[model samples]
Target: MATNSIKQPLWAVVLLLPTLSSCGSMAAWWTDIGPSFVLQNASTGLLTHSLCHSNNTPLYPTDPPVAFKTKYAPKNGTSLTATGWYDTMTTWASLFYQNNNDDIVNAVYKCNFETGTYEEIESDVISDRSGTPPPNAQTGLSVALLGQQEGYRVFYHDRARALHTLKFTQVENWSYGNPISTSTNRSGLALGSMFSGVRNVTVVTPKDVANIETIRLNIDNAWHITTFPTPLRGSNVTNLSNLTSLPYDTSSPPPFSLQGWDGNPKAIGIAIDTVLTRHIFYIGTDKAVHSYAAFVTGLTESGFRAQPDQSNEYWPLADEPNSDFAIASHLGSSTIRLYYLSGGQLIEAKYKNGNWDPASRLVVANTTVFTNNTGPVEEDNGLSTGAKAGIGVGVTVGALLLITGGVAAWILRKKKSTTSDVEAHGDEGASTTAGGAMGATQPASTAQSPDVASQHAEIARTGSGLSTEKWDTDVKDMALTPPPRELESPNLASELPQGIDRNELPTKHHITELP
Candidate 1:
């Protein structure tokens, strides 16, 4: 009877076909319904709106009010507790802050110069225990966006008053390795009042490569610079063991030391020029903006030259008590911008074409407009929101298609051995053809100019723009001599060591007049 029933229907089977087809169609439509809604919501949410559309007012509706007031805002009073950098690749401003609670937070925001609108894509706390327990006011934060891997590296002082660094890649969350202990006891150095008081931190990667270097004042009351090669390639962690300290004359004697000026809690700024020259700006105890330059020649006697004597002029806010400064440089450009707080307003100066334009004092933002308290901020002349939305949609669709196609291919291979065999054979021929084509298209080596060749060789030998071989040699030579005893007072301005002449110290350069 069952066999007869199965045979009964050419007509019946034909009639049932429409219903089965309809069911399949309904299933497909049902599967697509959820995604359709998601796409709609995502598109609408990402649509760009102008914050300054109505008037030429600031982007934030209320001054210093939390929701979307530039890249960062201080929760408390007018001390700028935030710093930001512009990412050219992403066209977004990445901001980091030490909030009122002493927690570290970072956010990425896009600005629309056309519409004057600001949009935040992501914001989250970087560290909950960012040296808040005792509330160290001098514990500033520094962030460097590594162009090689499109990731961020952060440096800060922890609650234990230790110097620590952490990294964040697009694929993974923030991960930190062992903190570099800056304790005088651990380092066998005398760091007086600057213990755990981090005035500033700056990081740079020369030639846009993996060789990362950082300069900061540790608990030892001295500015120390360290370099790490391939900093992003390790077991998802920074290897501090490879850290090599650079030379800075912060010894105990009056002639060698800047008399602990490097340890000041005011502010310090570092920038790399187009030719890989490093410029360090700091506020000296004399209330002057002191500047120093390090040429990329091998790290020998002439590695870094101090122009302290040249920096005699005072900056607008540089001499003000409790004032801090920040610096930013355009990638692949000779222009460097300096920012500082003056009368609760953010001001800027530009260093371009071999001169610092102090008269280019542009008012970046008024702290009173957003809040009464001062906040450190960074700006970007970014793209429109509509452009960003288009990019976001395209990326989302591409990802979905890739995932769906991969799943379909996997399922088909699992269901049919014949299909797998056919694909394997095709892949083998394709791979062989690709290899032969690649070999055939290989170009002959082009000879580089003598100047270019020499530059490349130097980069290879030193693993950086600055050669460390001679510097290492100098260190080894110094190690042969007996170490100096710890100074009774970290500040020994009154007591001058014999046979040392302070007049012969490296001269400074005017901050705004630096070449």
Candidate 2:
């Protein structure tokens, strides 16, 4: 038995050979997610992460979240939590965090898709806007990066509760922007974009008990503030701040205790489907993950899902969920991947093919760093979901076709993948977005991803716009290789670290700005 176990790991390396050789970087499933996620060890001040190695060795299967630590963590960094944005075009990852002095720090990691490695970590302390108290990031960190030439944006709050953005350009790293808006948004500061392209960097902030305000960035570089209506569930209007009980969902099993809406905004996670539907995920009082959608129509309740623990027991916000969550989707695909902390283990939940995945995959973590992806996972297609119809996932992986028969069971699992509320209390949203244009600019962003043609991706890797910074690495093409990863091992959670806390959380504050 021992000999066979040893042999199994060796065979995995053999399996990985084909996957690694043809091309690297399959957007989300491969490079997109590999850089977007950064796990941490709070006790050790170390960061654990993985490359785009989905076909990991059997000794640790489910493409185990590989353990690694970057050398750039600041000496006085407290909490050690981080958020990152992986610019697919540049293969650059800007990881942001709060240092001991409460100053914003960005540790940049340059990655190579062809080589399959995110080898080095370099960092810098972002400068303020001439005189803005150094823009201390007093709240959680969130980031959103534009593809190709547009640059990137990171959001946080200073001690004064004012929202600040740290943006990037080839001409500069992160130059602090003037304060855009201010409120009592102590937590739940998320930066995302509903459509594609370098249009609006949507900012979701808790203004107060009565409202949630969104400050958006336009192509012309001006900021626009919009107030969205409360979440609607089947004609009933209710804000997350007022709900104290679980909304009924036929998909959910009954809970243990019914009373638990502590009115706190623990965290907010957002995912976008290739179809252009956006789903926002958050934990409800009953421990179920609540989802709501945002479109031109307005905010609508999508559904809620309560995942099962190891014991198969269900509790109402009594255990598991620490409320810190991060979700991202691959461009051109419908796959939405979400990560959250449960009993110190990183719980990975996926929504794809119109259903929420029930797989109980857990990544052990002493701490975890979260990041943002522009869109969903690689879809069921040929090239990074960029190829529609018969195009192969690889711009052209003839070899991958040979292995399809070998991993048929995994593909079958993918085919079977498998939603909540209605309430209206105010204006749905902006109607000025005729075709989702970025404020009188181009039509709603045509979200860019890897398109295939003779082993090259349609999107360019190097940007002529960036002013040639020293941190920038030599340009390399991300071979539009289809991900040839294996099926997830069912026992991934068991093999990883495990534990759950029964602690109850006290509610925090929400935003309160109206149009």
lDDT tens per residue, model 1, 1-515: 00011222222211111011000000000000000000000111111111221110112111211123423333332112222221111123344544556555665444332222334555666664333233233344555433222244566554444455555643445555335433211111101111110122243222111122344432343444443322222221222333333222333322233312424334445665444456665444454555556554432212334554432122454435323444444322344544443433333445553565442222111113222232122221121232222222212110111112233344354444221122322221222222111100001112234454333222111001111211111111111012111111232111111111111111011111111
**What is the per-residue lDDT of model 2 for residues 1-515, given as tens digits with 9 covering 90 to 100?**
00011223322322211011000001112122221454343333334343322211001121222332333353322222233322322233445655555666666444333222343445566644455445444354565654323355666666665666666665544566555554444333433333233343556655433334555554445555543333222323123123322132234333322122233444554555433344555554455555555432222322222223322221123123324454556433356655554443344555554655442323221111111311112112111221111111211111111112213333334333220011221121111111111101001111333331211222212222122323212222221123111111111110000001101000111111111
Segments of candidate 2 deviating more than 4 angstroms: 1-36, 55-92, 111-117, 185-195, 209-211, 218-222, 226-263, 297-322, 363-515
Q: TM per model? A: 0.43, 0.52
Query: Which run of 10 residues does model 2 get worst, by summed lDDT?
Result: 493-502
Residue 23 miss distance in model 2 (angstroms): 37
Which runs of model 1 end up more than 4 angstroms from their true locations? 1-74, 77-90, 128-138, 148-150, 184-262, 298-304, 308-314, 317-319, 341-346, 364-515
Candidate 2 displacement at residue 359 in angstroms: 3.1
RMSD of each: 25.9, 18.4
How displaced is residue 507 in candidate 1, in Å? 35
How much does candidate 1 score in TM-score? 0.43
Q: What is the TM-score of candidate 2?
A: 0.52
C-alpha positional error of residue 353 in candidate 2 after TM-score superposition, expressed in Å: 4.5
| Most lDDT-accurate candidate | 2
